[model samples]
Target: MASRLKKKCCTLYEAALEVVTSRYSFYKHDLEMLPDSVLFDVIYEVYEKGGIQPLREAFSRVDIVARLLKITDKRFCLIRSFQGALTSMFWEEVPRGTEEAVLQSQFLVEFGGGVPNSLAKGYENLCADLEDTQVQVDRLVETGLRLGGFLSDAGWFAESERILLACQEIFKWARKEGRIWLQILECCQKLLHVQSSYCHFEEADVTYNASVTTVVGLQGDFVTANLAVLYKEFSALHFNRSEYSLAHYWAVESLRAITTELPPCVIIEVFRQASKACVVKREFKRAALLAREVLCLANEVFDVNDPRYADALMDYGFFLINHDRVRQSVSIYELALDIRLAMFGPMNLHVAIAHEDLAYALYVYEYSSGRFIRAREHADKALFIMEKLLPRNHLLLASVRRVKALILEEIALDNMVHDAGTHILLQNAEELHKSALDLALRTFGERNVQTAKHFGNLGRLYQSMSRFQEAEAMHLKAIAIKENLLGSTDYEVGLSIGHLASLYNYHMKKYRKAEELYHRSLDISLKLFGESYSGLEYDYRGLIHVYHKLGDIEKVAQYTYVLNNWKIQRQLSLIQEDDPLDSVGSPLPIADVAALFFEDDLD
Candidate 1:
């Protein structure tokens, strides 16, 4: 590497490509050589000479390119400069005779890796290479951002602010447009605030609304995926403002609308984000449909082993998980994991996350089947890698620990653990869960959807040990977190009532409390799904138990009337076990139980 840099041919501009390729694509960021000014010079010189397209073509390693551009602040600034430059230059007429036109079709594929200033690696060299300004301000701004790496960590407050403002100027230029430009400009302003992390979500709500109002043109039919993203952003703004009904309506509409005319890639991504929103709403059926569409499209466009294909496959797996298609979910996640490990390698973060998610799914299914060892193995692998990469107090690390603890819980329950493993598992599980809760409360605040999960997990742990008081306290905390985060009528707030009620009835012998929770949960089921839904059976069972405990024959008969009304729903089962409440899967693994629903078909 030293030998390559020492040779001074090709104006050192060529060296920038080498540096980028090595740093992001092939090697780590080398701190050993070059001052900040000197390093920035290389990146600037390269951008000036070759443009952004060429740098992108050089990026065969997708992860490296994305990491260099997205993960690090320095790279993000530089990438933004390139992006701004491209947006500015996109419509500019090339000098008539010097270069051939680069079509938009090639933009997404070969040169897609570049920032605004660049094109595909080799393509720019063929195009007119006319401009060599005395100073590239874009480069200078990028250099300042790179310098921030050293400065911000040291609290060089004034210098960092100045550097950021300089970058913002470039941002403003990039976002400028005539009609489309207005929303683009607004988006740039909001992005600036967000990148600074100075403004809160309240600011995001207001700005995002303004930005969305201007940006909903959805003009082009080509990049339908991009249009879907724009609408998703719009929906997100509504979501931020607590207009959830509007948010859901818009998000579903956006995905449904744009995907009708978009390219396959765009279609898949549209579905991915839409699936996330569906998951948030517990609209599992919609999410599953979108995920399947992604899979089908991926099969047409990408190889079975492609990363994007794996992504689609992974989502399909998770959709299966959420829909109570356990066997299918496990298969999909496994296949995706296999492809990712083959193409990207085992240590990749994407692959690691897949392992974690799949492990959880397996753990859930393990309740009713054999070979949960797959779940334990995958979770352990995820835990090991996260512990190596993340900070000691990172919430993600804590989540990984929680995953490990769950796996251990399964192991303890499955094996004949007389003493040592049981004590260790219980001790570690409690500590890790507490850490996870604390970290979530600190980072996301107490009302985050995540805090409810932490509380739910601890609550279940307590309930398992017959610690009803502790269990009730934890369950209430979970309920409180959700009720505060979402409104009383939101689907999320309804979930806590079931478990908290279960504790009230199951162990505390408090029939009234359990009855109340059952009624509330049933109300949500009736509202969201309708009274004829199969899920209402759980509510019925809970109430039956409550009435049995109370010796209330009249009320029990009244409940029976409702039960009889849904005999078709009861004779069959299709309850989904995916939880907004539990951080982990349920205590009762339902896969085998679910299998009964399809048993006749299979037979």
Candidate 2:
């Protein structure tokens, strides 16, 4: 009986293969006509013994098998057919464009509901009788990771976390098997990456530390590269937490752990993180050097069109912006934007970030009609992308909205200069500022620094519109918030004071009140940055104007002398000709304000 059954199975398999190869057109319906037992045997044998071509041919007709599984109520057949499909697909190289479809199919088979009870039982039995547990574990890990990645990309943080945690467990089991430890470590790193991406920093830190400990415990010299990767992730975690010092330290450690055997991409990433940390710390020269190295290495090691090269360009642009090279920075940002647009198209988040950065730099470079239009265009693109990709109340979306509001305000101010339809621009600016303020209030609350900054911006906008009462109310609200959060002597408080002083000096013509506010602002500026700081020049000039207006000769002389001497000192210090920070008696402006939101150093 056994010999006869074997002969029958062989004959059925040969017939099925022949039909799959020769009658490809009707193979689907033909395969569906076969008995379930014979069909299952054929699929299993083809997946296991047949080479890549036959497996490909078999899977070409897998849809029919899938339909048969749905049509037939045979539980064993359903489970066996699914198992065979999974094996074939797992081993085959998924065609490039069909990744999403393949992943969807795998997800359905693994977790989609409506599996027959007997099929589930048969699957469990198959798992129990399988000799190679490692293969099963690997399949589970692969499926879970792919599903988790899909969820992560779709912004389903909670679902992705659940899948990633499952993958982590399977990886833990694989670790104990004494083989594939490096692959297991790689899996753990991927979990850490997903955790970090979703802002689950605490859990990410735990996973990172655990993975580091595991890699160290393995005591294999071959795993040093993995150790470097863990350190790089640790550095990124610290960077996200705003611990630039620790971030730089770990980044250096990662570079140190890497040898010639490791890929240069890892080294480039370390340098990128290290450069970002240096930028955050205001180590401009070192940051510039490291950024240049990153760009050079990326150009040498990666394709010129690769996103890594664009990332290096973006970082260099940011560094240039920090050093007050706005035009140079804008050009670099344009290059980065072009590369990203070419690589990922216009709607990508990276493209959005490049647009935001370039808009800010253009706005700061000059507030002409041309630059204002360009700035508004870029700001709108950034806002559009953020609206599509992020939740309504996300802090990142709020930040983009704030930048857009600033660009609109700049356009309104530019129109006010020429007296060319200022009302419409001002109204649009006002609306955007209010929307941004609302978002900031919702995301960061009223007492937050971001909320206070929005209030200050709106107050400035109102002052420009000659809405003095509303402007006073907004400015005072901003000052109250800043003082409450950062105390009276903070530089931010000084900014609010100077803005109010400007309102009184230029618009209200209240010289006495303006003089008082200017004095207060001068004191704060003096304390925060000594007399030599450029910000003090604004306070000094404001006080000079206020004292002159008030007909106070002695105070006027004192402030005039101070202003002149500060200018001479600035000359001696060799400050640039067109320093934006040297703007007289105004808030730091949107460019500096935007800097406050970029605390992460990287987009």
Candidate 3:
């Protein structure tokens, strides 16, 4: 009736409302005091006058009548009750005062049915001449679903849930009458999406169970495809709960049932979730392989220049870098940068991110072969973009500045001499490192991972300046923070430990301390990436030097044999690189090579 009143003219209802509000409060008891006959007379007069005005002075102050009617929601459902009043006043003279009772009856009928579907019940009663209720039912379901979606998007979850439940009830009614199977499934999907989004996990679990049951009961071609979609939602449900193993299991199950029926986006999401799960489980090789498949699927499904394809490429590139394929990642990062540049121009945050990633790749590549110029160029570009786009102390700005500083440090070390120009280069590098560290400290405080990273970068810079005591302090801080936050066995903690080891072995001549640190760092690295890690070479050399200084000839010879055997194994692994997606070979210099390359004897 509210919907109908919106479509039709409600001038008389407006006049009555004006008259009632001016005389009495909007309370139900106050509105009930006005006589039915007198109110009807006033409405009729207003209708006759073309909805001009309603004056309470036209009636006597003491006019009262039967109190059979009740008010709800602090106002009259004016048009609905007024319609009955008009019918009795005009045409039903014998039943002159019967309209008020009819109004009350209609209200009771609607109140019994429920809120969203109450009007639909009224429609059924009014359209009793139409025998088919199916058309009305279909319209109700369609309108309710659309409204539910709109309300959900607007963050009105309660209203959306009510409307969807009404739609579900309609479907249930239809099912009892032996109709509608797929429609029920579709409604369940929509309802469960909303339930999951709002973290109504218990309700979503029930909906999920009902959807699975519906799927089992369904008789269709490729029912398993629908089952796969359900499985995908289940995976997401568990993923949100931080149950990675269950999420991965369901994701794999969904992948197995993949067909042309499933959307391309769903397929990509399944692979992405599986890959993320593998990463959380520390199955890096498997994660990289799955990430490669996501890139392949995205390349085939999306346009080459699409942002989604670029995003997939970026993910694949990051995984490749993590799994020790930095050279390939450089090209991947280049492609992502090109796409973002074309899509959003050069000044976008995405473009800056791509530059930052490419810069990191080139920086890591320096230890393998050396690309200092290209790496510095990308790092500077990233810094320039970030400085323009971000606030002065933004975390991203701090990160790009750190990368540029590291690049400068590398270049300065490469041009080592007792010359004025080299001193200026070192000075610039130190300033950038200090600025990055200050920004990190201000933005994330002292205990954050980013702050720890900045601390480690300063340690490397100070060590280059031959400030061994300062470098030791900085490395110790980084190690303490990383060990507290990321655990002692984290890859980052190992890097910090190794940096301190390098500082002791190469600069301070603290052979015993250097030996202990190198061994501890090696133990951490072996636990993280195992025996074939290429970065272990740096630790081996440090141990060899330490043992030589300590006059332990047996220990020195043992490390030499180990280092030589490691080099031969690395050579054989490079020869065995058969697949582009294979990330399980001898580990290359994993990220942050500066931590491992303090000495020129690394090669």
Candidate 4:
């Protein structure tokens, strides 16, 4: 009955709503003074909420009384109104009054069946639909490009594509709407997913495959933006794939083509996405440079005081620390931290993150530069900020504790350098290593990659103090974990192997093992970067050193000869090399000829 396209019941319901609205409140229970329309409207509101039985019975009785007396057409639903209301509730899954509810109803429909079909084949149809939609939308874009611009006023209104997407989404929502759904969904889906779907008059007849009538009514600023969005999604997902460089290039083009003026924050969002893609590839230098450029653009286009600019500055600081440029990164981070403090006060999560990050940076630089006292100060600040923001056993606070212990050990190593010949430093290093091991094991779990990092750092520290046996154990555990988590061919795994090989070559006098590890590390490093040439430089030097330790004069000479050839080849490569900082636009220097020491000395 609800699905029946009858106009009288809907009209009568609206009339009833009018009579009772001013005088009747749904919550009221004053039955004796209630108006006649109150009964009809009460049933109507109940029907809207899907409250079955009570409203249905009341309306059915009213219908019978009116029918027996032949009360007439205008108020006929007065008796069967409740039944009609119930029927209208979910008929054909037509959209509710708003978009959100429509999406919710889709979920409700899906929940009608329990369990997934439990096989890949069950999902094939769903995937195909999405792909089919993608194809049609692609065609829509080419048509729009050919036509040149939008066609009408409804098309011009803000978010016209949303209206179009709504048509498809609403239709796709049903198991029964089929053809009507396809036509409507395709119409909107084309505007967003395909550009060439918009018909062009000039291309009409034998001149074109489609006519101007194809556009329907696509015009105005909003329509232009809708079309531009299709182009943006296509470039982001297809042409660029993973390269941040290509993605940023297209984002700029598509953003400019849109007729509407996007907010500065939205523009900064594009920069954020591109920078993240760079970071995902571990291209820290490029990411930091892009983020810095974005920072300048954000502040210039928006406000110097914009929180987003400060946030961009903070992101650059993170990439710097990851790339080992902590010394130069400190000032930018401090600036961001100060800005967040001013904007959100001391306890904000943003301020806390900045404090923690700056502390981590200061810790790395302090120990490297022999300033443990200043490093400890920053560590304390980090601890305070983290305590306010996280639980007691949070991994970050525990990590900071390990950093403090490392700082103390570094101070011990400095004092022992003049007096005890590294014996005291070695002892302090053991205790600090234990602290790192304990904290990392408890905070990140024993098998975590981060736990392995702490082990490796401790191993290197011990190797520095000439504690060969202990360093060997730590490095072995680190290698095993790293090899399992990151493939053996990864640069980090190679670097760890090289560190172990160096200890055996220089301090332990284990020449055979040193030669074996060096070969292993070299093979992996060469696999990853041999073609790039720069990567091969470090690994080749390691191999040369290994050959020297084994007293293989012929092998050493052979490796050395290859290294020289590589240097010459590097000079000739057509890569857009960031000319060395020392070069400063001058002709490249010849290292072999200009060297102060003889090549034989290196041998």
lDDT (CA) for every model shown?
A: 0.56, 0.64, 0.64, 0.50
Best by TM-score: 2
Off by over 4 Å in 2: 1-132, 139-166, 172-185, 191-224, 227-262, 368-370, 417-459, 462-543, 550-603
lDDT of 4 at 144: 26
- Model 2 local distance difference test score: 0.64
Which stretches of candidate 4 lie above 4 Å from their native place? 1-277, 283-293, 301-307, 324-327, 341-356, 359-373, 387-389, 417-447, 462-467, 516-548, 552-603
For every model shown, what is its TM-score relative to the native structure? 0.58, 0.59, 0.54, 0.43
Clashes of each: 13, 0, 0, 23
Tens-place lDDT digits, model 3, residues 1-603? 899878746677677665654443333344445566445544434434433123212111111211112121211222222222222222232355554534433332333113323333333333333334888776656655555554353233444566677677666546343436656776776777667645566778888888888887767563565656667677766654445567668766766666655666666766666666556445675675567667666766777866667777787777767665667788889988897665544444556778989998889877655449889888877776566544566555777788888887877778767567777887888888888789666644787666887899899889998888999999999999988876777777888999999999999998888888898999977776666677889999999999998899999999999999988876676576544444333322212222232223432
Candidate 3 TM-score, true structure as reference: 0.54
Provide the lowest-lDDT 10-residue window in model 4: 148-157
| Model 4 agreement with the true structure over 140-205: per-residue lDDT tens digits | 322222111111110111122323333334334334332332343235424432221111112112
Question: CA shift at 297, candidate 1, in angstroms?
Answer: 2.1
lDDT tens digits, residues 430-488, model 2? Answer: 88788878867764578766788889989999998899988988999999998886678
By TM-score, the candidates rank as: 2, 1, 3, 4
- The window of 10 residues in a row where model 3 has the poorest summed lDDT is 59-68
